[model samples]
Target: MSLLQTLPSLPSDAAYDLVVIGAGGAGLSAALHAAIDGAKVLVVERTAHVGGTTAWSAGTTWIPCTRHAKGVADEDSLERAARYLDRVVGDHADAALRRAFLAHGAEAVERFEQHSDVHYRPYALHPDYESDVDGSTLRGRALEPLPFDGRQLGALFGLLRPPIPEFTVLGGMMVDRTDINHLLSMGRSWPSLRHAVKIVARHAHDRLRHPRGTRLVMGNALVARLLHSLAQRPRVTLLMDTQMREIHVSDGHPGPGRSIEAVTLESAGTSRRIAVRGGLALASGGINRDPVWRERHLPGIPMDWCPGAPGHTGQAQALALQIGARHGQGAASPTFWAPVSRRQRADGSTAVFPHFVMDRAKPGMLTVNQAGRRYLNESMSYHRYGLAMQAEQCRSEAGEPGAAAALPSWIVCDAAALKRHGLGMVRPGGGGLAPFIADGYLRHGATLADLAHQLGMDAATLEATVATHNRHAEAGHDPDFQRGVTAYQRNIGDATWPGRNPNLGALTAGPYYAVQVVPGDIGAAVGLQTDDQARVLDAQGMPIGGLYAVGNDAQSIMGGTYPGPGITIGPGMVFGFLAARDAWRRCRSA
Candidate 1:
């Protein structure tokens, strides 16, 4: 019997007009919008729950020309946005594709807010990755989610993931840089007072009545709220622990009319195929967590930075490949890899690269290789960060006499830096930074040379680098490397400093500590190619009927560089909105 014949058929249920694969920030955004357009929607998630890696994200959505940019109306323009993108992505991006993102991104945000519970607060404060680039305004391009009550999620709370404890979640938390500084100040000013009391009180209340203990709210808090809105809708059906195995394609008569008839899914011990008369939207996230695929696609870098779901192994990508979908080629390998650090959870298992890297509450110190040499700019963009790590490894291999190999860099800080800038090394429930120091994970040394020896580096070289850096610190000018020069860098730097460079410091104090740093990735930037409408393209760059991808699973339209905080989610939502609109149009036309 054929595979279709061998499988028991599902009952003649109502054919879903739309099938969205992943439930991440991107996938859910697409599904909610499709449902709003009055399409019968079914969202399938591979994990036991939904929310994907977004639950752990900082929840900032970056968009240029947003309502927040109204004050600086004269500074930003569509042409400027285009120019900035051209400089960053270069010839890698198609002009049409870039135009699509810029033109539709604002509309998509407005549409999402109108149809769903995803309310956006215009943040006039966020910075662009490169503020100096044309169309790159200092503000008005980014908006973050307003805090929501997780208690509303109810029993569905267990179906969602919780934010890491190190992050504050009470009082509608915003994980931006300023919020972190507030958290730190609260801790220091009132040492005896509970720093996060409001958050804890709300969390405790939710735990008492809610089945999941705490309601989940995080990065793009509005996105999660929006998903909750859809879950409450009578029309939307969310299937947890279900995986889409393949898409059933119809070989239509030779024309621009071939389409998908249904999608086959595997759940529990049984398999069922759901007919897709309208269209199938693949928002299943990227291939950042799949070790096998990472080894194949991004062989050069370590898989450290991925904050995506464990099941986000490109199942949708694989399904597309099986359907003869053509893959796009550019750099032959992933230009960026998510860099993360290994943090041991309470259960003994390790959680890699929580939002601490981006959280202002905890400052991310500079990373040095095993040989105690600084390799890359600590404040560089994530894509550039990955490239720097890889370059460091290459330099180590060349062995130009006595070069230190860059295996994994160390995040060094003195007691003052630790106190001023929080370290993510605290125990799950325990307060204070004792555990990290008590355990060998965070090593403390009295002097620069002693710290170098402890980190297994050439003592003289490390001492000299520190001394030279100190001279720059004393003069309040970084000559060798401009550490706190850029807005992006200064945004993450120590705001308490009187000088312009917030990231600059002497590192002259005793009891210096070092936390080993690894290349932690947010997600893979490369994936299957798509058009401006989020349509999957074949080898000839033609749209594949009934197949569309958005978010990380789709090749980043911005090439490998991150223009702003929400660049990933912003486009993901925009393309997702476009795909839903196009799918509706296609279904209605048929």
Candidate 2:
């Protein structure tokens, strides 16, 4: 059944103690926890799907010192977590918000595990992005959503939002951290072969009854578990394809004078006003979809290649701004970024793939500017790669002769890397790559000089760059940027390679390939200013009653830095809990 079919019809004048706008991980979590606190809650989703961009994510939360991590041998404590935050964020992080996140983030995860069926599992080997930072550990800081059985939800499984199709294999069969390894080693290992066979059989069974594979995992699992938990809450209601048109103030004007009253909503072309007693939680994804705002904050970049969902166009930020909510300026870039490559699918539609992992960290691949000179440590996270791209662009502009072609970079790799790691959506070891080359989706040449000429890059410069890289790669060292030196880099690097340096394989194979790479953001970072309690604040730094912002909709408490995996959703979920509980307290007192 569709999500709308499962929803109850809205009453003519229905009201709720708390109204949550947007039904992603953060909004849904707020609604679920608020209902558990005995407050009547309603979730208004702009799209028919429940999960927003969170559904497109990896479902890992970079929350430190949770119950899931406490049992690990090298356990992380709140004190250490505080130290990490202080060093990573510096003056950018809000002192109060930082303290609050460390204090309540663990409790928030614990509360949900105790009261809801949704659960998280700690990664024993995953290290923080900045492994050298104080309080950083090699494990026990990142928590990923445990795999969920979609059969538990039954027909409601269709109501759960799906993950990015690019993340899946075998026609939409979702996989988790362990599942990927099992699938990758299918032919050589008996246990992997069995796992692959079981997955295929299950997907075949699901195809008979569903349009897409029903064996959900990863982000889909996270959303499904939350949906199931929310369904069990008697006081919670979810309405899909509902738009929050406008927000009304108590005095019929703006200025944050305790004026949050109600919201005007339009569903199926019919507008209705619903009163609110507690407050509104803004979790409408973020501003990645708004080009005007993107230009203002993140200049010289296009918003066409983002991985964010369709509905995150700064709706929540705009609504809050109507009542004098200040736009919080971040010390870091106004957005989180990733390098993206676009390809036309078989259906004639364009498919944009985010190079999140499995590409840059692999040996034999590197990125270069128009001059064919290498820049950056190619083994870092996608967020860092994006920043490096922009910084290179800026540096090129300052230098002479290289400024002409540095705005749009290119990812160059050898035949080995292309066959092993794959470029964008062109799978590794796949036979049919002629069409991709013919269509200009991929550029190839028989030799390095020929490839450089074809790509409009300097031939001598390209040759020198490869020679320098090969000299270092042969010895398992990267002198330029020290690639693969950090634990985080090596973890993402290829383990199958029997070499001293996992991320430093020389690109010396036959034919070389190059693909266009542009600066692309995964989501917006700058957003509404809020206090420690999550209440939206004004220009004067005063809390605006009845207004709270969480997730990407608010200025990231990480101070615009991507600390680790799930940084976006983890704090979003925590603050969502804080916002809902605060609303419960205010409503109960009333």
Candidate 3:
């Protein structure tokens, strides 16, 4: 049964030991942690479904020194991870929070595995984004959620948010990194053929009974596990379609001694007041959609570019700010960014597909600015690529006569690359290009010159750029940007390619294609200041009693630097776990 139907109603006084706002990874983690500790917890979700942006993500978490990484990374330690963070994130955020995450990340993983339904396994090949940084490892720091059978969730399975349509295949079958590889090589290898056929058959069977595939993977699985654990906890109450209106503190003035007294919530067009006995954990994704916040921090980017769930309206952050909960300082960027391509779906909704590792870094592909010149390495992390776009756009906006803008940058690929690597929303194997071209989402040309003209760029410049790339590619090196020099870059490149460089190949084939990409804010980096224990802090750096923030609602421990896979989700879950324990401690003290 759905938790909403099974949960008992709140008492007449509407009192609870803890209240968690937002039902994303962090909020769910906080609520689950509290519930496992025997606290009466109430989880408020504005959206009908749980799992915020996390649900749409790849579901990788970068937690160093976890039990899952024991045999995989004997050299890994908190000190080594700290050094990498110091090199990449240095002074952009509180070091204490980083330390706290490093120290307790393993414990948090262990706790959830032992006491809840959540489970994870260390990735064998996932590498940190900043492999060039000191003390970085090629693997063992990243963990992915083990695929879960959504059938186990039964009716409650409907509560989990579905994966982005662009990320799925055959209507609604979710595929992980391994599945994609196996599916792509099914025709060549018998084992791969068996695996692909098995999954496809399973998904086909599921279509008859379930709305989507019952075999959940990635972020969907992570959320399903958390939801399953919460369902088993009788003390937990999950309220969907509930919006928090106001946060009532213990005083009229904002002070360090302030405590959460109650909160006003609106649900189904009715407003009600509820009492809080322990603490309030704010995990409402982030402020990415807030108009003022967007204008102030993410200028020049359209609000529609953000692929995160709509629940992150910043209402909770604004409410927290009203009580003097100032935003954390010194983040390298206000928001974590990714390059995304947009297409109009048949349902009239726009699909904002993030271009991470699927195409750009592969052989025979290249990214170019409006001037039709390569700006940054194509193999760089999505976060770094987005940052580069913003930098180039900023330079162009400064009115330099010939400065090229990176906004609306085009990723150009030859026919081989288009078929093997797939460009943006275009799937591999090159079967469905007509619809995308008709919709203006994909542009193709008989030659590089024709492609450039179609994209409204100077043909001569684009031809020259392609010639230069091909020259370097033939030599198996990209000296200009060093595309595949890093371990992380090479790992994502085509491993089966017989070329001199897996990430490089001559773009000389006919029928070149291009797709436009814009920088997208995947999550927030700047958020309410919080202490090491996840307590929200006042302007004076004093902890505000009974108030906590996690997920995107709290300043990221990475300081806006994407050091590795799952930086955001890893710290989010860790801090959420800490916030719940701290809240429970306060309850016992009271």
lDDT string for model 2 (1-590, tens) is 12232123667677889999998988988888897787888889988788898887888887888877766834568888888888888777687898898889889998899999779888868878887788777788788888877888876676678777767777788877577777778878999999989988998898888777877777788888899888787788777788888988777877636657889888787787888889899999988888789778778876666767779999778878877898887567788888888777778766667887768778888888888988888888788898998888887777755444556777888998898888876777745688889988788888999999988987999989999988888999998899999998998888888767999888887699988877678877788988888899988888887888988888889887877888888888899999999888879887
Q: Quote model 1's TM-score.
A: 0.90
Predicted model with the maximum TM-score: 3
lDDT of 3 at 163: 96
As a whole number from 0 to 100, the lDDT of residue 50 in candidate 1 is: 69
478, model 1: CA deviation in Å? Answer: 1.8
lDDT tens per residue, model 3, 461-550:
999999999999898999999988989999888999888888898898889999999999999999999999999988888888889999
Query: Per-residue error at 429 for model 3, in Å?
Result: 0.3
Model 2 TM-score is 0.96
Q: Clash totals for all models, in order?
A: 21, 0, 0
lDDT of each: 0.68, 0.82, 0.90
Best by lDDT: 3
lDDT of 1 by residue, 1-590 (tens): 11011123436554777888988888888888888888877888887666776766767777767665677554777788888888877766566878998898788888877777787776655678786566677677777777776656656656665554445444333344444444556656664235445545655675566543343444635545866778656667777778888788887332344578888888777688788967788877787777777788666555544555577787789888777565555632363444455666668866665423442212324567777766666666555566666777777788765456665777776666666555444422224556666766667778877888888888897777667666766776666546667777676565667654667666767767776656666666787888888888876667878788888888887777767777778888888888889888888998
Candidate 1 Cα outliers beyond 4 Å, as residue runs = 1-10, 72-74, 165-179, 187-197, 210-217, 252-257, 300-305, 331-339, 354-365, 401-403, 426-431
Off by over 4 Å in 3: 5-9, 399-402
Residue 337, model 2: lDDT of 84
Error of 2 at 341 (Å): 1.0
Error of 3 at 356 (Å): 0.8
